[model samples]
Target: MNKDFNSIVKVWEAAVRKSAGPKKRANRIFSTPMSVAHVDDDVYQVEKILNNGDFYTGQWLNNFPNGHGKYLWTDGCMYVGEWQKGNITGKGRFSWPSGATYEGDFKNGFMDGKGTYIGSNGDTYKGFWVMDMKNGQGTQSYPNGDFYDGDWKKGLQNGHGRYQWKNGNHYIGQFRNGLFNGNGTLMWQNGNRYDGCWEDGFPKGNGTFRWCDGSFYVGVWSKDSKEQSGTYYPSSGSDDDPLEWDPMDLFSVDLIDCYVCGCEKVSIFPSQKNLNMFGLEEDNNNKHLLSKKVTER
Candidate 1:
């Protein structure tokens, strides 16, 4: 966002220089006609048509545009708003050739305060701007049915925000550089939710996953969310009873006895054959949805 808006500023600066151009560069820029040229100390303001085909019709003070004005560039870019000295300031609307527009408050020629930016691609951003970048709080909506509402920094998602995927998945958490970081909650539409810490976009460290069917796992998840070393308590056994695990395993308990399925230690991999054992095949391959599709299960 910063790089693209700067191009418009460059052209505007050049045009301002041409307003007072010298004869040394007469080929591209010619002298302003006396009728509309800057008249120093004159209280009256009039429209000016420069030789380069640019147009400015507004209030001028001394020799610079200062107050309300309309500036039209030959390249099809246009600005209609307030002006201070020679810079675009106060309230205004800047439109690009592609139909993209920015309407808001400006200070020192940069988009500041609050504004709304509508892109040519149907993306709309309404929020706080600093130096032409989306900063502070804002809401960015896409044409793809996805939406993000929360904190923004330097045109990217930073701090905390809520992102809703077009596919019915949503995450509420802290973010750094657009990826999930710190503590957060990711809830799948299928009724499975994970509350934990995430690094980058993957879940990591200690967390808990609760399935739609009421089965749950509490343990430390690998960075990839592929495997979890914890206790899997069956829905029927809400008490202290847990499915028997390998005695040598670190998560094993000393005297906990298995009673239900006679199921011994369960070693879960991402294969459908292993996941179908407990009717978890509907959410297979997702890995993280259940660990990554067992810990990638």
Candidate 2:
């Protein structure tokens, strides 16, 4: 074995002896391949044994907690797996003194990884973690039967995801700092659906909102209110009308004007009696009518 390994083993042996006490010496001899160093400091396994005989185990390097290990405090809190200089690191499991249990990645003794935590109240969280909190993608279930599945950050629902309440209310979309922000869609149990941008949990920005009663609005939204907008056109006939119309029909009026104006004026009237016949009418009606008329020589 390497010198370092041998030295670590010796230290581990001494720690075991110290913790086990003289009475338990004859029970068994504990062994490990870990070493201790008193140069920069003392490397030793630290343990706290309760009066009831429950034991907590961990490591101390250079008189401080270091490396990968665990500690079960006398208070009933138990931490197992991974350590760095006495701080939790890497993947591990932790059971709170209150009966809650967490299993996942760890960093500096905090939960950080792809893991799960079951709360004492029966709620549960399963997903990515950061510093003992839920962050990134995951799922959370409430004890009261509510649940959320979506992106998370620093233990809050942030970014995009879906929230389903026990009352059958649901919101799916962008979130910020746990509140509805950006764009989202809300579906209420009453059969109404609101699709639009949100700010501070209120509808804000442009969108199309529809109610279960066949009413809807498509326009700019401002803080849950509809501004100037267009009709919803709820019926299927309104939806299909535009598609049924021929594309060429839009130019029909213009086509008629162009054709008629290009034709000869005489051909348009077709009767000389109708043309300049106005002159003869003025002559017959007396010069008073003629005085009102300008001679078009």
Per-residue CA lDDT of model 2 for 1-297, tens digit only, reads 244744654454344433522121112112222222233344544443323333334555543446555543333455677666435667778765445777878765456779987877777889998765578999888777777888988778888988887777788899787777898887767776778877776656676666577656666555222243334445443543322112122212322221100101111101111111011112343321121222221
Which whole-number lDDT from 0 to 100 does residue 239 have in model 1?
62
Q: How far is candidate 1 from the true structure (C-alpha RMSD, Å)?
A: 23.7
**TM-score, every prediction:** 0.66, 0.56
**How accurate locally is residue 181 in candidate 2, as Cα lDDT from 0 to 100?**
86
Off by over 4 Å in 2: 1-55, 58-70, 224-297
**TM-score computed on alpha carbons, candidate 2:** 0.56
Q: What's the distance in Å from true for residue 139, model 1?
A: 0.6
lDDT per residue for candidate 1 within 153-233, as digits (tens), equals 877788999987677778898987777788988877778777888777665777777767887777776633345566666
RMSD of 2: 41.0
Off by over 4 Å in 1: 1-43, 224-228, 237-297
